[model samples]
Target: MVFFGKKSPITGKQNARKTTGLKAASTRSIINKYHQLNKRKLQLQGLKKRMKKAEEQAKEAEIDAEITQIDSEMEKLGGLEVYQKASLKGQDQTRGGDSSHVLLKWLKNEGNELALEEGQEKKLLEVGCLSVSNAVSKSTEFDTIDRIDLRSNDPLIKQQDFLKRPLPKSDQEKYHVISLSLVLNFVPVTADRGKMLQLTTKFLHPQGLLFFVLPKACVENSRYLDGELFDSIMASLGYEKLEETTTDKLIYQLWRCRQEKAKYQKFTKNEVRSGSTRNNFCITL
Candidate 1:
């Protein structure tokens, strides 16, 4: 009787395939969790709005608690972009975030206001510029634009740790405009954020402009910073606030570097502003 040896069910190739499948599933699960949390957060926001409109104080309090819980969970998971790598494959390529649109509009409306000769090249430095194709497209008026990011792989983006290294001599205080969109929030410490601001000034000309974008939470959630306090801090750093806009989600400000010492001498713990009124200060250049 001829008997065929029993074939093993698990070969090396099969095991490798199984591992790959498991990894892909894990990635999908993470992405799904992120989206679910995001969707729930939006829903809670709507509920909060309706509760406020109806003047249901009790219901509004409950919804506020739920929203706070969600925010805590999101913070644990490393913010809304935790699964960005996995979701990028399926996300709409055309949709730029709200901040990008704001930056584009600012560029279009204010690009010419910079004191440069009509034909002179304006040097611009953009930090944390992940996939700045939209910003670049809107910046055709600029003579030269340099973009840098720590994580981006785009050939046009210089991959460098902005906090660790000094800029080349040729680039020091050479840029006429520097744009930093949602970059400060990544620095976890408040002092480090201030340090980052200081470093940014090193790359800007004496009267150059810094277009800054940050999450509105920075002002609302911090006991140390309010609208007026933030303005004072900027002034102390030699930045004169040219314009500012505060929305529900983000804060946009345009400041010109004066290369002067901080005019505000003290920062007291008791100096917190009382109310939570959103400030939208703007000036015509």
Candidate 2:
């Protein structure tokens, strides 16, 4: 945690360093501030170290200097309370009786090899996976995922080339499962939704499964294609809806897609004929 004096707002020139006076704080004061900030930073970093090491050390010494440094840093970076409140509000929004966690738990526990395929040890694919955030692994027994693919760039997944890469063919001749969580709702790219599904399905064997989480939310003015319209799309592509559960809101649902009676078949249509319809957002905040 390094601290610097304010820079020139217009010229964007960095202030020159000085040994003393207004050009810089006193040596004694600067040293004291850095020492205090460094100590707190080290302490916070240590907390993330092995729990054993943290337990061995006594609590950080209560120091007015350290508190003052922290306050200064907070002020320079924007008040801590602002981010705290925003984060808290986001948590509240996700906690409002969503079945995502419950469904994830069920899939993790009961899904097993059936979800993957016969003779397969364990392999999973996440389609339209976003930044590894809100992943189902947290709400279920699954921890590590084999692979994840996202259409958008995120801090954790900045490489866009990964999306265009072709999936390696699997050796198994049985079913394989690919999980799509809250991703199919944003498939607005023209003529790519079905192609993307087919592209992924080609990686699986005969009885592979495609698990999807569809949002019923308003996309009246949306530029992307979503799952609500995918019902006909999936059916046309030989993918059958196994289970679907709608929450109190029509804009969200948990659904599963598997191949029809005869497996390994691809969709015949390349063009979507339905005119785009605009839906109203009914959810009252």
Top lDDT hit: 1
Q: In TM-score terms, which candidate is top?
A: 1
Model 2, span 178-205: residue lDDT tens: 6655444334332444556656556555
How well does candidate 2 score on lDDT at residue 237?
Answer: 54
TM-score of each: 0.59, 0.45
Weakest 10 consecutive residues of candidate 1 by summed lDDT = 10-19
lDDT by residue (1-51, candidate 1, tens digit) is 111121321111111111122344544455445544555566666655655
Off by over 4 Å in 1: 1-98, 107-112, 117-120, 168-173, 261-285
Whole-model lDDT, candidate 2?
0.42
Rate residue 130 of model 2 by lDDT.
41
Q: How far is 56's C-alpha from truth in model 2 (Å)? A: 73
